[model samples]
Structure formats: C-alpha cells, structure tokens
Target: MDWDRHNRHIYNKVIDSFAVIGKELASPVVLAENTYSVDEAGILSSVLNSLKVLAGRHELKTHRGACVERTLITSIECISADSRHLKPLIIWPATTHRSTWTTHPTRGWHYGHCGSGYTDTMISLHWI
Candidate 1:
C-alpha cells in the first residue's frame, strides 16, 4: 500500500484502541487529579544563520558565518488533565547561575543550571 494509506491505517488503529481503552477507564475527576502531561523544548538565544536583508537591485550582499554568541536553554512545562499547570522550568547550560541571564526573573517560575543544559533525572525530580 502507499505510504500515506499505510500511515492512515496505523493512525486509525491507534485511535480505535484508545477509544476502547478510554471507555473502560476511571471517571474524569480521578484521572484529572492523577494524570499529568509533560513537554520539553530547547531554545537557542540567537539565530544560527544570518537573516535576510532587504536591499536595492544592484546592492552587494555579504555572507556571514554562524552567530558568535549562542546559548542553549531547555524549558519544561507540565499540565494536569483538569487543566491545572505548574510553573515552567528553564534549564541553562552552565555550572552556576548568572545575573545577566535575566534582569527581571519571572514570578513563580523556576530556573536551574547544569553542565549539559539539558533535562536529566535530577532536574526532573526537582521539578516534581
């Protein structure tokens, strides 16, 4: 079968299975209190490549290398089934915190730093 058809078949199968399982699951209130969804995303402080610029028809263009200063930070967010969400956590790639990271820190949010700037078991535990 075609790739699209094959994927659609698999998607339908998974959806059907979920519907069957959902029917037998606990009530909404119980699930809402116990179930949580967590998601993470990596952020780069600067653009990796040069941005496009508007110029005249005869203007000369120069190509610059990748951005010189770039920082990688990971953000993790969690929400429960009933729409309650915890404060977002930001992980910086450093051994210690720096004042320059943010002039005004966001209220209620959390910040942490690690060598790799990625979320690990310890960070996850701390968030929980």
Candidate 2:
C-alpha cells in the first residue's frame, strides 16, 4: 500500500527496491521464456474465440483462457453494449498442457459434468 508522494526528483525507493528483488528472484535461469509481440497476442486472442465458434457459441458461459510460454489467451468479455474488459487470471503457464481451450458448463459433452477438466483449468465455468 506504500507509494511515493509528491517528490518527482526522488526515485520511488520502495518500488525500486522491489524491482531489484524481483530481478534477482527470476535470474537468467528463470527469466527465460518464449517471447511474443502485440500482433501475436492478437492472434492468440483470435484462436480462443475461434475455438468458441467451433463450439457454436458467441457469448461464452463466462470468460475463460489459458496460456503456455509466450502464447497467452487472456480472458476478455464484451458487455454493456460492446464494452471492453480484459484481465489475466492465470499468468503462471502450465508445463504439461500445451494447448489451452475452454468448455462451457452448458456445452459440456455430458451437458454439465464433461467440462470439469476444461472448467477446472480455465476457471470459467458457469450455469452448469
């Protein structure tokens, strides 16, 4: 809750300290990852929605997404007559699962129970 107040000349010491600690926590061994650019991120966004289209739904049961390395699909919800919302719930990419997709509670293969795996991993299940 601490933040620098009214002193533009002085650096944000608290934040700077944390920045160094953060770098140390994730050294070269941990800092490695597959990098991506904005365009690639856009494509990932498209990929998830594309999957939703294949599932035959425009409005998802709720927002859901998954990511691995540089390929991240952040959750997005458009409401309030095309309002925009974006939030990343899962930043810690999984190691075992390569492709991340969502399965709605209603669209579950068994109509409710079949989505446990997707729902559990994506954290986007609703109205089962």
Candidate 3:
C-alpha cells in the first residue's frame, strides 16, 4: 500500500465534494415560516446527518409533533445545564418503521419509525 500525498489530496477532495453535494440535497423540511439562527457548525452537521439518511432510497415512516404558536417540536435541540435552546428546523425522512412516539430512557422526544407503507415522501413537524 502506498500512502502518497496525491492520494491523500484526492481522498480529501472527494470528501469535500460529497459534503457540498449533501448540503444541496433537500430533506423533509418541517418548519419554513419559523425563524432559526444556526451557526456554521450546526448547519454543517445537520446537512451531513441528513445526507447519511437520504443517500439511498429509504422506506417511509410516520410523522408527529405538537404544533403551537407557530412553533413545532424541533428535531434537534441544544441544551445546557439549565438553559435548553432549540436548533434550526430540519427535514429528514425516517428510514425505519417507528415514527410514532416511543419511550426512551433519556430523551422523551422522538419522531421516527412508524411502520411500513412509507414510501418516497417528506414528513415535517409543524405548527399552525
């Protein structure tokens, strides 16, 4: 095996290109009217995670959330010791069949895996 600088550069370039393409790939947007100010890191991570799920043809799932006052339960939240802040709204389809609310040990909020019959479609949590 040869570890050449050219090979490393090419690998890095491919990864960088993938990241750019992933960002362009849209997700099941939940909130469009709502407002959110996410830093660069958050945006990058969100895009990367979304691409991980949307890379190939995925099965559908259920979509759920409580919408109140133009605010919906965000998919991602950044919390500290005492202050919990919501992250930017994102849209990513559930690859499994368990979208309905499930009981988790730590976080009590999950919106994925809703059973079969979910095809190519976008599911987004929103408020009226």
Candidate 4:
C-alpha cells in the first residue's frame, strides 16, 4: 500500500477529511471572517477587557490585533446584587445602571480553539 506516493497525498487527504469533521463536531457557531482595523481593534479590546472583568478576571489583553470572534459565554450566572429574581439572560449596555447586579463575573473560558489546519496536525500527531 503505497499510500505515501505523490508526496503522501492520500495520507494528507485522509487527515484533511478528518480535520473538517473534527471542526464541525467541535463548533456550533459559524463566524464570518473580517479584518479588524486598528481603531476597531481598540474598541473591541476595550469591550473584551470589560467582559473579562465581568467574568472575574482582572487582567486585560495586552496584544493589539484581530481575532475571529466566537460567541462563548460559559459563565453568565452571577447577576444578583440583592435578594431578588433576575432574568435568565440580560443584555445591557455598559452605560446602563438599571440592574442591581454589579459584581465582576467570569466565564469558563477553557474551551479549545482549533482552526482549519490544527485538527489535521492534531490527528497526525495522535497517530504518531
């Protein structure tokens, strides 16, 4: 079985096929690709830093660049200031002070972020 012929084309094809399947099974949301300018990145960084604080992590992002934003809010369950009932989900602007919940929050933030070629490499590594 000279599957390694043509520069291991067959082996690479198999790896690539599994890579697509792996990505599909690992993700539920499809994010649109976009280039983030410096100004937009700054604005996004501010919002993301605030979000991290809300999630209970005080450290801010030091890098300045674009990221393929994915919606992953794992820990949005600490929204109670006083002894009262609150909505299951709340979308409030940073300027609003209507809700009593003000404590900093954090998400699990522990999910694997693998892109197109990562899975193929991962699979290849597993076999090796």
RMSD of each: 7.4, 18.2, 17.0, 20.6
- For model 1 the local lDDT of residue 61 reads 32
Q: Which residue ranges in model 1 land beyond 4 Å of their true spot?
A: 1-30, 47-68
Weakest 10 consecutive residues of candidate 2 by summed lDDT: 34-43
Question: How should the candidates be ordered by TM-score, best one leading?
Answer: 1, 3, 4, 2
Q: Which residue segments of model 3 deviate by more than 4 Å?
A: 1-10, 13-15, 18-103, 116-122, 126-128
Q: For model 4, what is the alpha-carbon lDDT of residue 32?
A: 24
Clashes within 3 Å, all models in order: 0, 0, 11, 4
Candidate 4 local lDDT, 15-71, one digit each (tens) = 899899678655645332221111101112123422222322222244332433533
- Candidate 4 TM-score to native: 0.18
- Candidate 2 on 1-128: residue-level lDDT in tens? 12234365346776798798677656665432322111111224233432333332433434334522234333323222123322222221343433333433222222112212222433433421
Model 4 alpha-carbon miss at residue 36, Å: 38
- On TM-score, the leading prediction is 1
Q: Against the true structure, what is each candidate's TM-score?
A: 0.64, 0.17, 0.20, 0.18
What is the lDDT of every predicted structure here? 0.81, 0.34, 0.36, 0.33
Against the true structure, whose lDDT is highest?
Answer: 1
Could you tell me the TM-score of candidate 3? 0.20
